[model samples]
Target chain A: MIVAQRKPFEEIMNMLKGYKKVLNVGCGTCVAVCLAGGEKEVTVLNTELDMARKLKDNPIKIDGITIERQCDREYLAELDSKVDDYEAVVSMACGVGVQFLAERFPQIPVYPMVDTSGLAANQAVGWYEERCRSCNQCVLGMTGGICPVTMCAKGIYNGPCGGTNNGSCEIDTEQPCAWFMIYERLERQGRLDNILELHAPVEWLDQTPRTLVQPGYKKVDPEDLV
Target chain B: MKSGSNLEKVLKAGHFAFTGELGPPRGTDAEEVRKKAAFLKGNVDAVNITDNQTAMVRMSSWAASLLIMQEGLEPNYQMVCRDRNRLAMQADILGASALGIRNMLCLSGDHQQFGDHPSAKGVFDIDSMQLIYMVKKMRDESKFLGGADIHEPPKMFIGAAANPFAEPFEWRVHRLAKKINAGVDFIQTQCIYNMDKFRKWVKQANDMGLTEKVYILAGVTPMKSIGMARYMKAKVPGMDVPDEIIKRLQGAGKGKVAAEGINIACEQIEEFKEMQGLAGVHLMAIEWEHKVPEIAEQAKVLPRPVIE
Candidate 1:
């Protein structure tokens, strides 16, 4: 999912301080499903920004477009005819989609309107909560489906710290102890002995400073690939 | 075989308030074939078969229109610019005419993001205004926009949309002028609820000498209940319902709101009866089509006048 949080309106207006003839380009894939970069959201955002700009004595000429997917070169090619009409583009997508739009419309300045958050799932209609941390090694099979890296505070390798007070993490009182969840999950699977296995001290090098390079089935050249 | 085949003639006849719609099967069930043609049969002048309603993959509108044709219902097949370029749009207009789908509604169509599938491609190579001019070019000159000759000339009744209640009301009238200038034969407006604003808009059109440019059907969708009214006002972008009607629904018991909403619409039709220069009403009671004949009778519009 394209998990994104809206940039504050003040922040967005700050970015487009001097620009007129802006295009509020939306990405229709992941960001759209999340309701951040869809046409409806773009319309609402455009209204808000226009109201803000008008209050500031700046009447900006803004038009909108929701391209199918900003990541694909073919889809981005759809903007070729209309790009010259705009001075800048505000892309309402993840960081990846923003970069892709920038690469496609190299002459036009593309600004990001969303902050890309960690991988998450919608808990229900409007709530999104983090569920998985791609730690490069998935040990959910051994741990009975509890994701210790994401759920456990301090990224507990083995057992809980003494800070667990009434099944709550010490990091924050409302936070549930991840190790406790792992223990309960293991108990349910009839493999309580699994918790005795001592894990080695771990480093989250790849997980931190995350950079994803998906190997190609892409038809275009690497130089041409956005 | 003559100009009677043209759209303006069919609309100016004025007795039947004709409308067209596109219904892609909600699922892949094959029985939807007979169901579609049967639903709209004889209910209106023609049923519109949509070309990829919302850009989701479905049975093509041509095949669906052909099915409706077999069911003996005239199909007003709609063509959109999102899926084709001008050349393809021109080709499809000829193709539709050959297939005996006479009435056409030219649309720019909704963006792909609004549909269930978002990763699909968008080809908005032309807007609705440009498509109208292109259709006129093919019809009047027997040639393509580039001056290329055609083997046979094609003629069609053309229509576009107008929504005075859409935000920034001034722009809506501006767009109306553009559509009339583009040679739209008639305008099937977005669902209208507020008659006061609508009357003002008609006055503006008349003041600008646009009252006679193209036949205008004040599009109306009668709500079945308070829930339906709320949903329509919420989801159907350009549709509006007045607070008094909302409060009327608020006062009327839920069990009888359908009849109440129908009565409210019937009242609107009664008031619309006095407006001069009207073609007819386009009642889009969506899914409640069975109530149409009753509502028309309640509004005293039944035993439709024989006008030509």
Candidate 2:
């Protein structure tokens, strides 16, 4: 799931403090499931703003609008007539949605209301823990389905490293050392001997690295992408 | 000044004031409601008598307000549009005026799904905005939002709610402005724990013209116990409890936590009272009734604002 944290209130306030007409736009895909932006959350925000403005002696005019998925242009196409109603749009979707909205409605400045944290999974109800860094590598197969690249503090490919003590990693006591989990899993599967074998070093991609590709068989799709 | 002008006086009071909430009983249990009103009197400026609070079936806000008034306490009647049409609301406004329940807080009411009766048909013929507009029309223009003339106009001090620390932060400020434009006279916010967030929201509200037109009351619910604190943070959708407060409450132990909770509440009230453009504080104690007095005392808010 796409994980995000709410933008600092001061930052958000500063960004929208100039506008009188505001549109709170919610996205119903990843941000919705993660509870960052949804119909319920949007309504909640609406109530808070309503109350705050009432105190300052300058009550504002606010409206709410939500789209199906902002990553796709087709969903945002529905906001055609509604965009002109407000002076500014407070986007509750991910960082992608904010950029898409900025590009689509260049006239009205779009501001992101949430800081896109990272990919994470729900730890429990209303609880989420960061799980992946989106390192653009898949080495879980060799590590018994437990990712060492993302889970390791040092990102050590073949390491218990001297920093490991007991079952925990050195950097954070909250985390279990990735190699320790791998060792236990291999022992349980009667594949402990594999630990002794040498494996080649990995070249991990950093940042949001993008790549283009061509098909080997039928390559006509290059023109279709445009 | 006439007692009828107390609403304006109450609003005019420097920010850091206190209000209380009273959820009316299931039936016409005047004894239970009177007992509650007695518990709240002299301790709070206005006691909010809920109208079908939690969306469960209960005594109406108008009756509850009159009953509380009979028990010698000012009542802020909570009205919801979930079960009433424009006609009932219009008539109900007249009925409330006849009973001398002048202070009313307007709401769209909780959805049926959230309450015990999920299958109960909702009668949201008009939302809170339309109802507020109608009330304004009757009182200000002797007409409703539709411009229809009314034989008996009603007088009310209208208030609404806000939830500032909700997850999707950006949308809340603008939505608040809409309610102010809808003609709300005052606003009572959702239970707030994150004061830092609230300060920022207030600035944003000021920018939106929300603070210019409406009086605001910051809502606060004291955590009576550590267990209750956990429940409020995790279960209460909009209540965002800081980790430090949780740790503090945890370290305070059982007997000490209640006192600690009350102390924290007092500190918040003290801060709220001094804020620029702040109107007041709305205290929702849930069932922890008697502690409100002690909290008010500790906060140094005594000789309460009387409708002199």
Candidate 3:
């Protein structure tokens, strides 16, 4: 899931300073699972922002609401009636959701209250660790299911560089060396030859903005209309 | 005659070669490189000019290599994968070759977090192994990594580093084999203090018949002080310093630690001379280049074999 952290309170407050009334929006998907932006978090932030504004000489009114996944257009329809009532919208969602909210209400200014970090796995409650980089090309089949693109610091194709110290990366002793783990796993599986297979340099797929059309959803040819 | 380099000539002539290291100064002082080169000019076959070693900013290695060449010493030009992509790497290879540099050492540099600029982004587009293969391809096949023909390709004696003492000890030999398969002509092991582990690793390489494929150089660094030894043992990643060496340094009597350090290095060189499948010793007198001549002389590797 995409993990995001809320922006500092001061930055969010500064963005809301000019507005007399604002809507605090939240997403109930990735951000909520990471504990950054959810229904409970939106209510808490709304109360905190209300109190903070009241203490300051300039006071403002703020409303809060959380909808289902904001990435989908259907769930975003729930905000149509209440969005125009406020002067501005502050989205407490991943970057994607924030952009979607902005697109949904073009008249009102949209500000992001959270910073999207990375695609991660929820290790435990309130703990998230990055597991994938969405690099488009996956090599887990050969790497013994370990993602070197995300785990290795250098992200090189052939690794366990001389900096592998005691099965840890040279950058940090605490961080396990991805290649070392891959080697150990492959060795145990009696597939050590996999490590010897040279991998060509990665051809980065994200060089330009990429749009994916699901196989079944691609537009039919115009010739069909004729 | 792969590169027609003096280091290559020495190894090819069946001589026990000796190489020294010269870390470029942090600032752009050409005299600093020349001054360090003076100490190693006649003492060793080639001097390895490090490329932003330890990830700290320094005068570029190619520039330092040219500076040392002016002093009549051959340079083993070192390039790391941390700072450049394939384009820059190949461009530098052509540029260095044009400048008459024949020896090149490829390394996956230290992480930027350990350097002055921790926030800097490292460009490890190609790791050391890939770098080796690329250099070899440019040299032998006269083709760039992307398969375009180079009008004039760089002919370099490619070298790569190996760390036998690093974790998953059994796999280190296989890693070296992989590097050898990548077209590396020489191997320089990481600094040695744990002799038992190194000997075992070398034996494994010999057993796998990897020693016959490439020249192997044993790395030796003279410990300047007890603090240096302790720091390397506890803090430096991938370095293995045995407890006995520390005890020996402590027993060197007050103020005599430096001399004892040289003695210990000399002793390691003596052992390397007798070891099978070993080609040479790479002396990394970090910040202590002045002592290399004495260390070489004491180790009886002096009057370095002058192959015609």
Candidate 4:
């Protein structure tokens, strides 16, 4: 799932500094699951802002609403009727939600309260490790399901760099070397030959800011293929 | 004929090559580089000019390399993927070659957290491996990364760092081989203290015939005190400091620790020379650059090879 964490409280306050009445919208999907910008987080932010504003003697009005998924246009439509009542909207969703909310209501100013980090999987309670880079071309099958593109510090397709020590990365001794894990996994699966195969240099330029259209669902643009 | 530097000639001639490290000053004092180069002038085949090693801001390696060249010492100019993107890196390579800087070492520098500016964003647009391949492409094919033609390409004897003590110890040799395949002409490994592990790694390289494919220079950092030994053992990443060596340093007491450190370094150098697939030693005396001559003399690499 997409992982995001809340901005610093000072930065959040600064974003809502000038606004007299603001609406804080939270996403119930990824952010909620990650305990970042969930419905509970929305209420907490609201209380903090209310108290902060009261202390400042500005006495600003703040409200919060949590949509099922801010990325979906249908879920965002629920806020359309009341969105105009607020001076500004603080989106506590991933980057997708902040931009989608802005596009849905162009008149109202939308700001992101949480910074979208990366695609991650929960390792333990309140702990998440990044697992994907969305490189468009996935090599998980070749690498024994480990994503070297996101795991390796260098993101080299071939093998580990000289920085691999003991099984950890040279960047930080605590972090495990991704290629080492890949090799071990492949060897355990009797597929160590995968390491012998050479991969061409990745074309990262063509893979970024990519848009995908599901066939038979969204209209496909022929020009996009070019 | 790439770079045609003295280090390249010595290694090509299969003479036990010796190189030293010169860390440029944090300030804009070119004399610091010259001073460090002077210490290593007659003792080493080449001297490496570090690029903000450990993520700390320092004088640019390209400028320092040019300065070291003026000191009559061939500079192995180092580049890190921490501050520069491919565009800047490509331009700097061309500029270094135009300025007669011969050798280049590519590295994915330490994270910014270790540096003065912890808030600084690391620009790892490409890793060191890709940087090597990119530079190799530009030099051999005379083409830019974007497939643009280069009228005159930079000719450099490329180098990269290896840490045999790093984990997944079984994969270290294969990792070195990967760098060699990526167009690294030579490799200078991380500071070595564990002779047993290094010998095993070198043996693995020899068995795979990777030793014949590329020159492997073992890195040696002479410890100054028992405190430095303890600090490296506890703090330094990828450093393998055996407890016995610590005991040896501790046994040396306060006054003799420096001399004891030199003895330990010399012992490692002796073992390194005998190790299969080892080409030479990259002496990183750190702030003790002046001790390099004495250390080199003791290591029996004093009469440095001179190549035209």
The predictions' CA RMSDs to the true structure, in order, are 25.6, 25.0, 2.5, 3.3
On lDDT, the stronger of 2 and 4 is 4
User: For model 3, what is the alpha-carbon lDDT of residue A8?
Assistant: 93
DockQ for each candidate? 0.01, 0.01, 0.71, 0.39
lDDT score, residue B97, model 3?
Answer: 97
The complex in candidate 3 yields a DockQ of 0.71
Report lDDT (Cα) of residue A170, candidate 2: 46
Name the runs in model 2 displaced over 4 angstroms.
A1-226, B1-5, B13-16
Candidates ranked by DockQ, best first?
Answer: 3, 4, 1, 2
Q: Which of 1 and 3 is ahead in DockQ?
A: 3
- Quick one: best TM-score, which candidate? 3
Chain B TM-scores across candidates? 0.88, 0.93, 0.99, 0.98
lDDT of 2 at B174: 52
- CA shift of B166, model 3, Å: 0.7
What 10-residue stretch in candidate 3 chain B is worst by lDDT? B299-308
Deviation in Å, model 4, residue A122 alpha carbon: 3.7
lDDT of 3 by residue, B178-225 (tens): 889889999888999999999999899999999999999999999999
Rate residue B123 of model 3 by lDDT.
92
* Candidate 1 lDDT by residue in tens digits, B1-308: 22243234556665536453547565555457566556555555666666676567677776677777787666666777667866688878888778776667777665555567765665555566667777777777788866798777676777776777654354456567767777688777777788888988887887777867877777777777787778766555456677777889778785887888888877777766667655666666665545666766676655443334
Q: Indicate the residue-level lDDT of B238 in model 4.
A: 72
- All candidates in order of lDDT, best leading: 3, 4, 2, 1
Worst 10 residues of 1 chain B by lDDT: B1-10
Off by over 4 Å in 1: A1-226, B1-3, B14-16, B20-22, B27-43, B303-308
